[model samples]
Target: MRDIMGMMGKVKEMQAKMEKMQEEIAALEVEGKSGGGLVTVVMTGKGELKSVKIDPALFKDDDVEILEDLLVAAHKDAKDKVEAVAAEKTKAMTAGLPIPPGFKLPF
Candidate 1:
């Protein structure tokens, strides 16, 4: 009974920490670039698209397909960065927890 209660307390604490982490992530902004910096994407840590930029030279070609590809690449870069940051933060948050080695958090 005591162990169960203690586990419940830990779960509540983890929930609170996750909430705080989400807020922190939402406030962060990350930038990703592709095509040698010709195309750039800005996104929040929560993966929300904020803005996009394209170099004037890229527009000269007026190649819609190429532009689409670059945009996709840039978005992927930003998303990868967001995931990396989230993983790092989660690791820090759960540093001292007793979770099993192969267990994954629902976050």
Candidate 2:
């Protein structure tokens, strides 16, 4: 039964690591920009938008639609970056665990 006990210990250790990783990810902040750096957004690893910035030069009435589009693009960029960060962290945490390729986390 030593093997089972050792496995249990490892499982507990992995659980603690996963908890810490989740905390770190929740505290992560990332920025994404678009439209020649005219638009930018900051987001947390949880996909929550924290802030947005747009260059004042895009204030023209005709550029409203363009500005809107840039805002959307910037948000998408930020969300993608957040996902990448979370995925990288999860991958690192699960390294050599023999998890299925398509498995999801949060166990």
Candidate 3:
């Protein structure tokens, strides 16, 4: 049927768009900071940690626990940002699609 053929065409187009979006997301970098910028983390949109930075002031032996906490917080913040970016990209890619309400794409 013509309708079925049209839907298939749309599906192919969506697939191409999704692949492009994935590549773009993988190339994105996000930064997150914690402890008043004493610690910072950089992560890719796929949630892979790219790097971490810590202020020299937090390098004292007695502040090991504090440094650890800051690192964790910074990493979490970066990951959250990455997730938000991915969500935004997905929303834009799926706009105007006939997906049902409350249906979430399995990413």
lDDT of 2 by residue, 1-107 (tens): 99999999999999999999888988889998999899999998787899999888888666688888999999898888878888998998899999999888963
CA RMSD for every model?
1.9, 1.5, 1.5
Per-residue lDDT for 22-95 in model 1, tens only? 88988889999999998999999878999999998987877999999999999999989988888788889989
TM-score of each: 0.85, 0.91, 0.90
Runs with alpha carbons beyond 4 Å of true place in candidate 2: none
- Candidate 1 lDDT at 52 equals 98
Model 3 regions lying over 4 Å from their true place: 100-102
lDDT digits (tens) for residues 2-81 of candidate 3: 99999999999999989998898888899999999999999998888899998998766776888889999999999888
By lDDT rank, best first, the candidates go: 1, 2, 3
RMSD of 1: 1.9
| Candidates sorted on TM-score, descending | 2, 3, 1
Off by over 4 Å in 1: 100-104
